[model samples]
Structures are given as C-alpha cells and as structure tokens.
Target: MKALAALALFLLALHPLSSSAQVAPAYHARAEQLLPLLGKDGGEKDFFSDLFLTAVPVNQWRALTADLRRQYGEPQSLGSVRQNGPTAGQVEVRYRRATVGFTLVIAPEAPNRVIGLQIVGAKQADDSLIKVIDDFEALPGQTAFAIARLTDGGPQWIATRAPDRQMATGSSFKLYVLAELARAVEAGERRWSDVIPLSHKSFSGRLLAYPDRAPMTLHSLATTMIAESDNSAADTLLLALGRENVDATLSRAGHAEADAALPLLTTAEAFALKMPANASLRQSYARASIAQRRAMLRDHAARLDAKAVDIGTVAETPASIDSAEWFASPKDEVALLDWLRRHGGEALPIMAVNPGIAPADAARWKYLGYKGGSEPGVMAMNFLAQAKDGSWYAVTGSWNNPAARLDEPRFVALMTRALNLLAETSR
Candidate 1:
C-alpha cells in the first residue's frame, strides 16, 4: 500500500505570462471569488477555465471544496496577497478551524481566471502539544503516537498516546526491511549498487508494469520501496534479503509484538489473503502458529500470486486490518528509528527522498527521513528527523478504523501540526 498522505497538488494550469500592472488586482479578485464558493455548490464551471475543468473535473472540484469545508469550515477572511509575478501570487485564507496558505496562479488577461492553486501550508490558532493530543483523540477511530527528543544521554519521551498499544501500520513496516538490508550491506554480504533481476510484482508500484526479470540495483529497489511505498519493489527486496532475516529485524529493533509480526507477508500475499475469494485461506493463516503460518506461506505460495488478488473486493472496505496487516506500537516504531539512526548509513538518503510533509515544515529539520503507509482504513507516518542543532528525533503515529474509511489528509494535517511544533522547539 502506498502512503496516501501526499499533500494535494491543485492543478498548475499555466498560461502565457503578461506583465500588465492590472494582474495583481485581477488575481486577487479571482481568489476572492473562489473563496466564497468553498463549501457550496455549482461554482466550479463558472470560475474555472476549460483547461482547469478538464484537468480537475467538476465532481472533483466539488469534492475538494467540500473537503475544505468539512476540515476547516467556511473561509472567514483572506490575508495579504504577495504577487510572485504578473500571473502568480500567494495568499492566506483564514477558516473557522485553521489558516491555510495557498499559492495562486492565473491567466494573464481580463478576468484573470485561476490557472493554478496549491496549498502551501496551514496553521491553527491554538496550536500546542496538548492541542495536538486533543485533536488526535477527536479523530474518529483508534490513534497512537509517540515523540522522542534526543539528547547526548539518549532519547527522552517528549509526548505519547498509547505508546505501547499495537495498531495496523500500512506500508510503514517497510522500514524494518530497510534496516535488514542496511545490516547486510554493513556486514559485507551485499553492496547497495549490487544488481539483481526484478523477480516479484504487486500493485501500487511502477515496477508492476515493467518487464519481468528486468535488471535493477539494490539501491533503486530500496529507493522506490521507501520513497514511493512501491509494493512490488518491497516484495522484491524482501524475498532477496530473505524473510527470516528481515523477521529478525523486529526483535533486534525491540518490536514489542515480534511474534505477532512473524512470517511477515509480502504485498502479494497480503493482497491475496485479503480478497473475499480467499476467506478460508485468510482464516487458516490467521489461526495458525508462527511456524505453521510460515509453512502455510510456503505450501500455498503458488495460490497467493497476483492472479489471486481482487483489487475491487479489497477496496470495498477495510478487511482484516487488525488480523492481517502489519502491527507496531508507536514506541516500537521510535525504537526502530533509533536503531536505524545509529546503523543506517546508505539507507538514510533513500528515506530522505520523501520528506512526507510540506516543504516549509520539512525545512525546519537539517535532515528528515520519512516513510508512511496507508490503505482504506489504516494510515501511519514515521520520521527519523535531525534538527538544525544536530539533535535526532523520531516521530511516529497511526490511525485505524475497522468499520469505515479514514480521512488521510485530515490525519496528515494534524501530524504536520505536531511536526511544526517540534520545529519551534528545535529552533
């Protein structure tokens, strides 16, 4: 499962630039026009150009605005607008729940139609650690998080919520695979640049469409596995590194539920078992002992391939998340990060490829290595972050709901707020 928490990129419909002095007011006017339509209906066709509408259909536009309304409430005011050029500028829109900053671009002509709009950042009026905890509790389902501030002696627990309670962690479990790969490299068993044939395939990745058995480097697989949460890339690496070896990472990294995480399933196996067609197989695997489950994976390996997975059935709703998906506590995740920080040399850059937060928030850290994961009803985000003062911290969190889908962006916004608060402390 790919981490579905990326910041939404409003279409950047660029047009020819104009240097007219009238650009600023027209751009501001268009922004003002768009603001009032949020949380309402039927303004997308009138305000958006054919190009914009084509890229972002009317239904998507409606859903985006409605989501804004649901999360931040109606737009209360627009702050000072800073013009980037004749057709571009930025503004802060204050909503009932939060203030959101947006970069706006427009056509260089009369009416100055909106050509692009991107959410750059957001902030809340009563931002605090306590408030962050409160907001986490306010979310619809089970939530766990841990923040540890590092010092010379070691890590000090700064804040936490159910730190020891295990929850489903979508693709975030790939961090352990990364740790094991790094360990092998350090032991001289393999090199990051070592080449191998791409031998596994799964959905939610670019590799699934590539020619089978195409040659690729270990580093390339790790990059896509972490940076994009590529399922195929992950499965290929897991099999190459050896499942038992990767399983050892859990215990070595202080995973609280190592036994529960035993016989870790590849993306393909997970998808295959979760499909409605494999109910009996899923039940048998769930009830089996660790050794038995391992045997089951071996004996049933052929039946648990790409052909067995039904994407439609799996997407219908959350299926066996508690029983089938990766399990980790917030504290366990922090411990894993601590191990990686001390041991992960080459893997650090691969993790840093995706910051997992807004550019403004990510800039607060000297280095931010992030990996997150998500599915229909599960979401998790973890970071091994280094501050400007050479301090290291691990921030990890998860949200899970077995009965319904999750609001990924809403959870992301809350986590981003927590990170921003940490940035203030580091400075």
Candidate 2:
C-alpha cells in the first residue's frame, strides 16, 4: 500500500471546458454523497468513481485518498458544484473555516461516473498547524517523531517527541534506491534511456498491472518510482543498480542504521515476510546467509499466492513488519534529504509529479517533492522543497503503532500541517 499512498491528486486543477449538457442528477447525487466523506475516512467516496474511467482497485484507492484525508478533514456542506467539461466538474466543499474545492472527472457515458477526484486549493493557518502537531505527539500509540524546517543551515523547529529514534519506514526507503541509481548513472553504468524488462509483479503499482515483458527506461523507472511510488519499479531499479550499491548509498546519505534493513527487501520480499501464516518461511529468510538472500527472496515470492495477500486482510498481523521492515529516523531522513539536495536534483522533477502537500502550501514554493509510505500500523511522510527564495527545507515524519490499526486520517492531517509549517517559512 505504500506505493499507492499519496498517489492521487492531479496537482494541476481540472478546470472545466465548455459544456452545454446538463450535469446529471445522479452525478449530482454522487457528489452530494461524496461531500460528507471528504474530511473523514472515505469508505463511501469509493462509489463516486466510474469503473470505466477510474479503474483503480479498492485498496489502492484507499491508499491514494490518504492524501485527501490529511488535507481535507470533514465537509460541513457543499457551497456549490459546477460542471467542468462535458464529463467532469468541481465541487466546493467547506470544512470548518476552510473552503476546499475538488475536481470530479465524470465519465462521458452511462452512470455519469466519477473517474477522478482531488482536493483543490487545500490550505491551513499557522494556529491549527501547531495544535495538530501537538495533538499527534500526545497520541497514545504514536512513536517518536520530528517536524523541522531545514533551511540553508538551520532547522527552525516545528514539532518533536523523540526525533532521534528510528522506526520502520516502509517504502520511504526508496529514496536510497533513487540515490543509488543516480550514482550509477553518474558512473556511466546506467542510462536514463536504457530500456529494462519487468521482472516481477507486486501489489500496489501500475507497472505490475502492465503486460509481461514490458520494458521501461531507467529514467521512466526512476521518475515513476517517485511519482507513483511504484513498487515494482523500485524493486526493478534496485536489482539493476545492485542491492549492495543502494546499501552503500543509504550509508552515504547518512542512514544511521543502514545495515538494520541489511540487503533491504523489495516489495515482493517484504510482502511475503508480512504473512503470519508464513512464520517459518520468514524465519528461514532471516536466518539465511547474506549470499543466499536474493535466491531466498525469489523462491519465497514465487510460492506466495497473490490472491491470499489482500492488504486489508493481512494487516491484522504484522508478523515481521517491526523487526524485518525498513527503518529510519526523522534525523536520518533530514540527512537523506540534505544528501538529495546536494546529489539528487534529478529526483526533484519526478518527485514534484505528485504534490502530496496542500495545494495552497505547495504554491508558495518554486519546487516541492514528496515521498510517503504506509502499511496498517506504520506511516512515513518525507518532503524536500525549494522555496521561491532559493532556500531548501526538509520535513520528515513517521508514526509507528504496532499495537492497533493507526488513525491514518489523523496522521495525514498532522503531517500535512508539518508541510504547512514549512510553507510559512517560504514567506
């Protein structure tokens, strides 16, 4: 699910083109139904999308909507709804003092389907920003966190509980993957245009959904891996650049416990390790020699049935998530982002493809790049932005609660505020 987290949102608002056709009554009803679900968990909002235009799976949809939940808390009522083009439109949904808009891309034909929905002009004030961060720190099960602004040479603090402690960071580890690939490109070992074959299909990615033998350029893989946080693309690029190379890159990027996630697991390998039913299999992989890790990963992934590993189902038991998952601290992420600033300019354009921050906040900066990852109990949001003033900043946050399912919307709200706090610094 980390791959799909923050995957929605077009960044650019979908302004309606000229349309003489009336907005369908059913579509209006669907938009009306969608209003109440805006700020809360969006279980019912799933019904708005037309199957023809929006073919995202249910689990993936939830993961993408996590961004909206963070940005838009709850809709009090719709101010108005306007038809955009013949098929899509924008709805003004008010949330407390905030009046956020969302573009709904409706289908051209039957059912007046909703193919897309994304928060528009989402913004927050300086006051509640502190409150949300404070409340999140006081959360009973949340872990140590950090929300600091990394300017030219300062981290004007925003929030922290135990900012130094490391926790499982899920797919946020792909930052190192990108760094290693960049290093490889600099060394002339890989090219952005090099076409590579897809090796394995994994949950939570567009690449896996593509037909077998589809070749993707190294540049395409790098961008999409950050853009959509594509898991298969991450794993594919990881293997191509050599796992050890990525490990070294993490170390270079200042990962405090670089070896903690030693021989960092791919989405395929990590997916297999999460099964409580495969306890023995997990132990064997852990105990296996370093030389045998790849073979072990392939052998295990090949045997695991994809249908059996529903993220919604297996989330109940994080058998190996805590101990076996990727680990990072806010301090470590800040260091990584700093390293990215010095060495990862190539990554900025790709990361900017998904403006995971509030649209209003994002508008304050010349560039904004984000990567967030989550499972059931763990979540991480890391940002690297360059303000219009030509200064850079990084805000990294993680919440780990192995005890129960996380309050994901709450987590997203707090993290979005962290970004808002950074946006304020840009002024």
Candidate 3:
C-alpha cells in the first residue's frame, strides 16, 4: 500500500511537468513554421537585403542568428502545419539594429511567406519609420502630424498618419504642374519662351486682371506661379497646356494620384488657391466681364481641388479636400529628389524660390531646394538637398490639427522639431 501511494503521487507530479514542457515546444515549433524564408529567392528577401545592407553587415547575420538561439534556447522543429486564416504560421523575430524591437509576422504561404510584419517600438521611434503603425496604435491624447525636415544632406521624415494619407498639397502642388510644363519644354511639346496670351478673366484675388491682349512666355508664367504663388499665372498655363497633357505629365513623373480635370479656381472648391495680393492684380481681375471672370474662377478652382492643398492660412478650418489614392512613400520621395538633384538646370526657376539655401551651403550641398505649404489647419513642406559628400535626402511633412487651432509659430516649431529628429536619427 505504501508503494502504491508513492507511485501515484509521483505520477501526478510528472503529468503536470510533462504538460508544461509540452506547451513550450508546441508554441516554439509553430513559430519555426512561420519564420520568414531568408534567402535571395524569397518574396521579401530584397526588402530584407536592402535593410540589412543599409543598416547592418553580412557578417552580422550569423551573429544575429546565434544571439537569437542563445536568448530563446533551442528552437523546435516545425510540426504538421495548420492554417490560421490565410496564414500558415506566425512568429516574432528580433533584430538588434532594426528601428523596431521585434518583428511579429504571419506567414500565409508554404515555406512560410510573410503576410504581415509588425514592428514594436516606442512612439517616437515608430513614427520615424513605421508611421502607419504608430498612427494605428496611437494612444489617447496623441495627435497625429506629418513632419518634413531638411538635414545637412537632404530631407527626412516622421509621420503620425498612414504614409498614404493625402493632405492638401496647397501651393506645393504647383511644383508638380511646373515640373510638367518644364518637361514639356524639354520634350519639345512646348517652348519655355512661347508667348501665351493673358486676359482680364485670368485675374483673381490679389492677381489684377491683365489686359486681355497681354502676352507672357510659358517660363515666366511657371516662375510666377511657383515663386509668388500666382494663381492667374498657373491658370493661364494650365489652359495652354490643357488638363489632359498635365495629367499625362504627372503620370509620367510617377505621380499616380494627380488629377488633371480640376478647374482653375472658383470659391466653392479649390485647394491652396491664391493670387497676388497686389491691388493692381485685383483690379485686373475686377475689370473683366463677370461671366469671363467666373469662367476663369471656375477653372482655377477645379485645378486647386485636383492637386491637393497643403498651404495658406494657419488659423481657420482647412478647405474640405478629398484624399488622394496616390502618395510618395518616404523612400520614393527621396529617389525623386535625388533625380532632381542629378538634373540641375531642369528645375532652375522653381529651385530658385528657396530662400533657405545660402551660397556656401549651395556649393557644399550642390543643389538644395524646398517648398512649404500652410492652410488653416494643415502644414506641409518638401525638400531635396545634396550634401558636400554627394549624398542627398528628401524630406517632407503634411500635418493637420482638425480638432483644435494651433498658431503658425507653434506649428512651425513642431515642424522644426520633426526635422531635428530626422537629423539626430540619420547620424
């Protein structure tokens, strides 16, 4: 009897210990099944390769694997795979140098393809890279803002919203239009010096109506449109180019979200629509026939709405603008800036608008240019600057405070902080 009781007690204890041990290995094996296939042929290998090449070293890859093993203990072999929704497995993998701590992912295909990967990090760190994650996981009291800043070499970013969130581009959209026109000149579709007729109807707000017979070159119109944020100049240029051509240009330049059909300007719907504040400009607009003026306004308004608005007053409700499906990812935006830098004289007049570039810095950076946009509740800026060492960066920001009003200085300060953060991170 004594032997029997002792044997039963031992069995009971053994059962619980066995169950606990079994549980861990079961979870670990499941993780192995979900681990991303890391070689060159894998779907996400290129992304990993780029990240590793940019931030880590080839020798470090083995070290990373060893460290993972040491910390986690022996990994279990994969078991009979079971499907979980579209995923075949799931796991959390750690990388020492990644901006985020561990990467949590779900593998949907056999051989464990990555269906999703979530990076874990502090709010600021997450904003610097996985901005969409930050926005989705935003806690109470956190306000989302897009940040753009110029670093010594170029531009960098941190977003508090999804990367694709399309805020109004304000006058910044003019940059795209101007680029298109410039390209047209380059392609022989239009000449920079070609005289375009201006009319009384072309004037609005601060832009005085020009005499109907006045003529200006395409180059002058583009310069005025960007440098001075001249609406009439932009409208006239758009009319000459035609909406279809402008859209085609944007598409060619890789701006898939750009819309070409928006009218030039009207009150009800326009994005960052503006004209010269000069009285003479206003008079020129006022002197035009009411119908002609309205037609001009209608066209201008359409163009503004189509482009997205990122600039203007900082104290009022931003104009109700629709979001765009197209956006420039942080990586792509940087590439575009690099392309512009490589082709210098092509963007001369527009580049000249930036007052921030000093002569000495210009020589060191080679080419640096920036555009800023502000509206009642939105603020944004984009820059492409080259470094003395030949490196370049593209920095951009689009911020909106819809629930409360923030002063311009405060807003600018916020943007400055974002820029500073980029500089600190890059170094």
On lDDT, the leading prediction is 1
**Superposed model 2: Cα runs more than 4 Å off:** 1-129, 151-158, 281-319
Q: Give per-residue CA lDDT, model 1, range 362-411, as digits (tens).
A: 87899999999999899999999998989899999999999999978778
Whole-model lDDT values for every prediction: 0.85, 0.69, 0.43
Give per-residue lDDT, candidate 3, residue 242. 74
Model 1 misplaced regions, further than 4 Å:
1-7, 14-50, 57-63, 83-87, 108-112
Pairs in clash, predicted candidate 2? 16-84, 39-73, 39-74
Q: TM-score for every candidate vs. truth?
A: 0.87, 0.71, 0.47
- Residue-wise lDDT of candidate 2 within 1-427, one digit each (tens)? 3311222245222333335466466567767877655545555444554342245555555555454455545557787888655556777767655666676666545555466666555444335555666776687565656665666564666666667788888889888898887777777787778898876566888887898768888889888888788887888888888888888888888877754557788776677667776678777776766556667766665555454465554556444666557888888888888777777757767778887765645776888888888887788888888878887777778888777767665666666656665667566
- The predicted structure with the larger lDDT, 1 or 2, is 1
lDDT of 1 at 81: 81
Clash count for candidate 1 is 0
Report the C-alpha lDDT of model 3 over 234-296, residue by residue, as the tens digit. Answer: 666766787556555545554433332232232212433332222342344345553554565
TM-score of model 3 vs. true structure:
0.47
